[model samples]
Every structure is written in structure tokens, then in C-alpha cells.
Target: MTTVIFVHGTGIRQREYNDTFEIIEQKIHAQRPDIKVAPCLWGALGAKFNENRASVPLEDGTLALSQGEEDADIVLWGQLYRDPLYELRLLSLKPIKSRNPFGEKPGDILQSRVASLTPTLELEANLQEAGIAEIFAQARDTVIRSQPYKGALLTVSESDLSEYYAAIARAIAAQAMFISELQEKFPPILTDAQLRDKVVELLTLALTEAKLGLGGWLLKPVLGLAQHGGTNYIRRNRVELTDKISPMPGDILLYQTRGEKIRQFIQEQIAQAEPPVVLLAHSLGGIACVDLLVQQQLSGVELLVTVGSQAPFLYEINALYSLEYGQLLPEHFPEWLNIYDLRDFLSYVGNKIFPERVQDVLVDSRQPFPRSHGAYWTNAKTWEAIISRLP
Candidate 1:
């Protein structure tokens, strides 16, 4: 029976690690009951942040987000960017404060625009892109069915049809983009942020064709959706930013500088494992495993599975501890299985750089980068690939 050793990624606390690791344990149990799973968890030995430490205040005094703030911001953007329907959903849920029954209702205009949109979208959404058509139908159905839509339909009496039509257009566009569905059918041609912008542009044309005459100006609110989300998120998680997320750089720094102890610990785990071992590592843990396996071959290790790891990138830059820029992987290195998600910016493919030595497998987490990075273990395909290679 093969011994599947599990290694965790960076910035992971004990509880989070335990929950993710448990999923692996259970998945392996269901698939190959004879196999044994081991832990090479190195987070405790890696870097940590102090929650009590207050963040350094900016000159204006708003706490600067952790060094990882930009990355965190990208994650927030990813949330809004990936889900085209998010903006409309938020608008549909808002309380209707004022309505003019004499005036056109936003829902009425939305329904009309959707009706106009159907034939044009049918060409693409219904045929070339059936998923988009489904999303379009669902989005329209959801809004029209909402109590707010019903209330707005009844109560709207204002002549200022501007806001009503504007909101309607945005909601329709946001719901119609349904980016995740598009990505599954086609290779992601644009980043999440880029995709959101492109969809908005397309939405304006679609609405114009449908005769709503809703231009980019009316759909402007969609552009700020991510910013609005980030502002609210920061306000809610101020403590988490200063205390936990900010210290993530510490772990990266620690692994790069004080790495011997981390690598040694992994070696020890390998030594103790039964024969036919697999070094299953994630993120920084994958880096350490690559570093250790490069320095000297441990007898039992037969496979090196890395999920969302930066090892290949590090080696290309000559930053990996054990291997230099010009050197090929040591002859003793185990067969490598590197798994990555296209949405995960931190995850790299090794096949391009390492050729036949590495196998790069892609899994769709249906999530943006931040969530995608951590979501590997939960993706069924990640295990399917790993299990297929298990001895």
C-alpha cells in the first residue's frame, strides 16, 4: 500500500489546516482504503503573525492593509469579477424607498429590455453559448419573480425613468455575463477584472439593441461594484487584516531565509513513512518539498504532488534553495505532479519549464485566485489525478 504524505501551504492556521487535511484523509479512505495518509504539516514551524500588534497607520491614519493587501484586494475584485450576476442580485434585494405608479417601473423596463434581448442573445446565448442563454433566462426570471420587483412594478409612479432604466440595465448585464460559465466553455481570454469590464461593454450594446438605449453611463455602478465590496469587507475585517493577513509575508520570508529546519522536518517525515511514499505538498509546503527532494533522494518517496505551488517559478528565477537556474532537477527527484488553477495567479504550471519531468493538471475551482489557491484539496479532480498516480 502507498503512503500518501500531506503537506500544507502558507499562512494556514492549525484549524484551517486540520479541516483541509481531513478532507484528504476522507477522500483517500473512500477511494483506496488500503493506502495510509501521513502528515508533513510544517505550519507550526513556519512563520506566524501576532494578532495583538496594531497595524502601522498611514499618514492619513487609515490602517494600511497588510503587505498582502494588494493581493487581498485582487481577491475581493475576483469575487465581483467572476460573478456577473452579483451586482444585479444586490440591486434586486434593496428596499424600495420611493416609487411613482404614473412613472415607468424599473422592473417593467428590465422586463422589456430582456424581451428585446432574447432574440439577439438567442443567436449566442441560446446557440453558440447556451450557458449564457440559461443565465440570461434565469437572471430575468429571478428579477421579475422577486417581491421587490413586484412592489416596484406596483409602486413606481416617478417620471424620472433614468434611475429605473439604469438599474435595470446594470442588473441585466451583470446577470447575463455569467463569466464562470463562459470560462468553462472557452479558455479564459481575459483576467477576472478585464472580463468584468468587457462584459459591461458588451452589455451596453446588447441593451441598446434591445431598445432600452441604456448606455455605459447608466451601467456605471457595475464598475464600482468591486470597490464597494472591498470597502465593506475592509470595514468588517479590520482586525483580521492587521492581525492575521498582514503577517503572511512573515511566513514567506521565514521559509526563504530560515528554511533548513523546515526542510529537515519534511525529511524526517519521509524517513518515518512506510515504503512507496508520496510527498503531497501545497503552496510553500510544495516549495520545501522540492527543496528537500532536490538536495537528496529519500528512499521511500516515489511521487511529488504539488498543489498551487511556486516551486517551478522559483527555480526559473534561481531563487529555489536547492536548485540553481542552470541546473536540471537532480536525477533522484521523484516523478512530479503539479496541479494548478488558471484563475490562481500564485499557482504555476511546471510542464512548460520542466518539460516531460513534470505533469501539470488543471482543476476548475469556480473561484477566484485567493479562494482558488486554497480550494485545491476540495476539488474532486485534484484527487483523481493524484490517486491515478498512486502506487
Candidate 2:
């Protein structure tokens, strides 16, 4: 009946993200296994640079890092999740290099077959059961007539022709799956991407039988067009720079400019959760949770638990995105629970500023400043405070 969304703060990379999440999850479930703990891992979307902070300079007015040759799928999926037509649009940007002046233009082959694609397999039952049997046909056409689809076909060749149809199948299926996946009754064996890829494989085989290369696998054609990109560096650095010195502060800097992606991800988690959801946010994650809930009311959210968060600080300085200095917490804002430690400079009390709207609880980890900031997870008193307040 209740879900706790563990919203982690800045600098917690992927590996640490998993480990830290497990720590809290196991601890919570140990006491109350009935409660579900969801992970809100938004660090990767935070600020990062492949050029290695090229924008930041030292005491002297010189660049910090040198240039690199090349570096990214989470990046693609991030865009894809937001816009189902994203990959189709990206494919359209590619110049068509096909010069096949042979029998049956590859474009025609694509349009003809693409319109009628259906799953002959058992998955068909799930589609029919979900009352979405026409999902494939609709998805296929949606991809075909799209501006990107037309553009991709304009100068295309036999080799890459299959790729376009497959992409259409993928885009359409992605949207359908995105909606259907939320239905607990119709569980999918394959993920949305996986299902699309499987269907694309079948289509690829059929197209190949028709005496066209279709570029072998759809993955190659999709990835071949894109070289190294900046987001790829975000992943690369997370892997390569695993040391403590690595800065994840870019999250704070980037969130101001590109906060929607992070907020949307949180919202998606909220959507998946049952009602009476509690957001257990830390640091910048707390800021994001505040910003999102402030702008619009999320149905299930009941309380926001901010551990050493800067949401109040940001609001005090008039820097909080959703609420300015003179503004008050929205009338519909969810209940707030702010946790702070005097030892941790990053932690701030919300009671003084927001009054009854938020309650600030102090639990000292005895560790000084920066160490105290991260010690909240390890301290018993912190968990005691958190557990006592959970709905």
C-alpha cells in the first residue's frame, strides 16, 4: 500500500547508486518487508563533461582539460522515452546513400510490408487481451508517415531501407509498450526495446529474403550513423573516474539548465508507485523532488523526506526553480519532513523559513561537515527518525 522512493543526492555514481540503494532497501525491508523501495537514480543525467570540465579554468585564465577525439544509449533512450519519434527523427538526419537503380525501389518494399506487420507469436494474445491488437499496424503507420520516416526514405538505399521500416516498428512499439507496460495484468517477457528489436529482427529476415541487405541487423544501422557524443562521456567518466576526487557537482550546475529530464524520471517513478508514496530524497535529489512537486501536484505523493537537502537553502536565496523568494509553498504541496545535521554545512533547517509547512529533524552523525553529509545513511538515529515518520 506504501512505497518509499529513495531519491539519492549528487555525486553518487552508478555503482555507488546500486550499493547505496541496496543498503537502505535491505535495512528497511528487514524491519518492514511489506514496504516497497524504489530507486530514483538520476545521477547519470546530471552534469558531466567528456572534455573533462573544459569550461572551468584554473586560477589562471586557462582551460582545465585538453580536447578529445570521441566518446553514449541512455542518452538515446532518454530522448526516446520523452519522444517516441526521437530515433526516427535522428535517423532522418542521416543522408540517404542508396543508389540502387534496380527492380522495386527499396522504399516501396518498406512501405508495402511495413504497414501490415503483426506478431504471429504468442505475444499476439497479450495484444488482443489488452485491447491493443492493432498496436503494430498503428505503430507501423505512425512511423511510416512521420516526417522523419519520409526524410529517411527520400535518399535511402536497399541496404538501409529495412532499417527505416524497422525503426518505425520500433518507435510505434515503444509508445505502445510504454503505455501497456504500466498495466500489471499484462506482464511482458521482453522489454519494450527488446520486443521492438525482436519484431525488427523478423522484419529484417523477411526483407533480406527479398534480395536486399537491409544492413544485416537494425542495431548497426541505428548506431552506425551516430559517432561519439558528449553524453557518452558521462558514462565513460562514471566508469573510468571511479575515484573519490571525481566531481558529481555538475548535477547541481546542470540541473538548473537541464532539470526536466531528472524531474521527469522521478515523475515516472511516481507514476509506477502505488498511492501514499513517500519520497526519501537526499541533497540535490531533495531539491528536484521539491521543484517538481511545487510546480504540479503528483497524485500519490504523501510526504517528502529530505535528508541534508538544500531545497530550503535554495528557496531562501530565491534560487529554487519552482518557488521564488517571495513565494509560499503551494497550497496543494505535499507534507514536508526535512532532516538536517548542524555538523553538515550542506544541511539546512526548514522549520524557521516554511513554519508548519515543513518539519526539520536533527540527528547528528558526530562526523564533521562533509563526512556528516554522507553519514546519514549509516547512522541508526537517522533511520529511526525516517522509520518513525514513514506512512
Best by TM-score: 1
Q: What is the TM-score of candidate 1? A: 0.56
For model 2, give the 10-residue run with minimal summed lDDT. Answer: 63-72
What is the RMSD, in Å, between candidate 1 and the native fold over all Cα?
Answer: 11.2
Q: Which stretches of candidate 1 lie over 4 Å from their true place?
A: 49-239
- Candidate 1's residue-wise lDDT over 259-371, tens digit each? 99999988888888888999889988899999999898786899999999999999899898898987888788999999999989899999888889999999999998688
Per-residue lDDT of candidate 2, residues 202-227 (tens digit): 54444343322223343443343334
Error of 1 at 48 (Å): 2.4
TM-score of 2: 0.52
Which portions of model 2 show Cα errors greater than 4 Å?
52-246
**Can you list the residue pairs that collide in candidate 1?**
84-174, 100-156, 100-157, 100-158, 101-156, 101-157, 102-157, 103-157
TM-scores for all candidates?
A: 0.56, 0.52
